[model samples]
Target: MKDDNLGDSLEYTTGAEAMGDGLSRARTSFGKQPVLGILALVASMALSIGIIGLLDAELFATWVTFFVVICVPVHIVISMAWELNYPSFSRKLKQPLKGAFFMALMLLVAAAIAVTVHYAQPIHAGPPTPFVLMYVIFCVLVTFWFVIVWNCWPLSSLLDNRLLLGLGILAVAYGGGYGLFTLLFDFDAMSAAPFYSAAMDPGGAFPAFHVLAYSVTTVSVVFFCLLFDFWPITLFPILRAQPLMGLVSTIYILGLSAAVYWMGVEWLDMEPVKLMVNVSIGFLFGSLIPLIMFEGKLFGNLRQPWKGIAQCAVAVIAAVTLPSIYWELAPLVSGPLNSGAPGYQYEFWMASALLAMTFPIMVVVGKFLDFWPLRFAPIR
Candidate 1:
């Protein structure tokens, strides 16, 4: 009896040790290859773009409108779901019910905006049955893609007490800026020839509001989730510092805007001044506005006065030189896509490709650059 009991205890200990080792190995394997993960994400996005591009012009426009107005908000809800269920930090909201409420509120607001815009320009001719069926298929495909590839783990740790604050800031900055600009200027005339308009219009299939919705949704998602939550870059030791991270993040976003402008000019035939304005708006929404609103929460912990000052300086520098840098690099990266040949007609495809090209650039910056002022300071 004593020998049997001893044997049983030994077997349990051995099994437990094996399980622990297996879990450790699994974590190391998944956690180490961020570049691989990013590449996979890029491929998935490209595939989705390709698939979505197959729809006819009108159907395509409608699908994109739906995606922009509905799917984008759904993505936000999904992110909030992750936060509620699988929070990675101590500061996150603990109550699932509260998280659900926030999610519901966000969706409701987004839906309200979408419904208002859609009704404002009601389609007198309802879409064909085939078109509706295709649109449903496209939505299904996009949802699967988002769930499988874009539902990143980094978002689980991205929030803090400042999330609601950040959301408020985002709303005021975007809403106020857009409203003020439209009030003061003829946006339709100014933006008529812009790349965003061309892409969103896609043979003049959508109204100006549809274009606006698409641009806002795409920019918000790309900034808040994709770029901000870029794991490989965010994990870099040098970039873990507050000010340095802020600077690099700002530069990266500007670079992306430049790339978009380049594509707009080379592929979509957008006017330079118009593209400039668009890029400026993008920079405002994606970088400057968020920075002011989040109070550097997007860049992680500051915990120092000097860090705040440095971040401000970087922001100013980025704002001043953004145009010059955009013009300089626009041609270099835009050349390949131009090639004196017609590029992808669909806007989503071009946008996806441009985004993919930027990923490698981001990886290079994250891997090689050491911008931290104190070389010996421990990485956050």
Candidate 2:
């Protein structure tokens, strides 16, 4: 949100209006009807589990890369540009049509990105980790700067068309993300890997996962804090104002995410990659379900610190519980899970499945489907 220079246009919404955005349509639908919401989400997630379970380790990574390269960023675009208002076509359509049309839109965009990555071969490295981190983690990191932190300011006033505005944000995402990626991440940490090299896997300023972990943690903060009615940050109007708000929030959160990630890496006995894949992502999935799917109704009456505290507990619960579930399902889905390189490739595959594959499925079900069958289901 900028100064009064920004206003709500048909193309996009800006300023404080962007605050708690996407909540009304998706949240109210689910918050008011939790049972229905759970039904829809359970159905969607089961399908996701089945699909991931089906793919072998190597194929799963490829599938994760393709799906994430397209879907994760596409969903972010939907949130930032459309504010989760899919099928922005002038007229209305029915259930599957509306959902199908929206999905068609997603697939089309995914196709475009897929084509680019196919031809460009941005990261011709050994695996999709570098590329995926750049595209999904780093790219979206910058996108978060504009869409969430910066409130599309400057651009919000400058660009009138949503498509143009979205494109503008994406330009910054890729461009800034490139610089940030090279600056913050390094794949040479994987020096043990066969693909290690100076050009493609050339190490960055920090170990790749250092930043990756930070970036992922940054995302978690977005869920429990800014998205939670811009809490704590909202307490200070001066800080909440654009530019400064974005600047301060971004820096402080980066500091916090780094600390937390490093601490876990140093203290925990578990494999860092496995811990990151299971716990970090598990928390993220945990955060998404309550916010986007359950619509934060579990503690609707609570205020920020307490509410956020409750949600944090919920996130932890999910981080601990869900991964165990996904692990149990993993063997069934893909026969056996791989631990790491030299044969095992389950970690990255698992990450992609969680972030790229399963995340999109959940969003499509909750947001695009509008909680469909359950929403339409009859009350006894």
Each candidate's TM vs. the true structure?
A: 0.34, 0.83
For residues 6-84, write the lDDT of model 1, one tens digit per residue.
1011001211132243312223332223333334333433444444445444454443444343433233332323222
- In candidate 2, what are the lDDT values of residues 214-320, reduced to their tens digit? 67677766555543556666789788676777788777677766666767777765555655676667777777666656655678688877877876787678667
lDDT of 1: 0.34
Q: Which regions of candidate 1 fall more than 4 Å away from where they truly are?
A: 1-31, 69-112, 120-174, 184-270, 273-349, 352-380
Best by TM-score: 2
Cα deviation of 191, candidate 2, in Å: 4.1
User: What TM-score does structure 2 among the candidates reach?
Assistant: 0.83
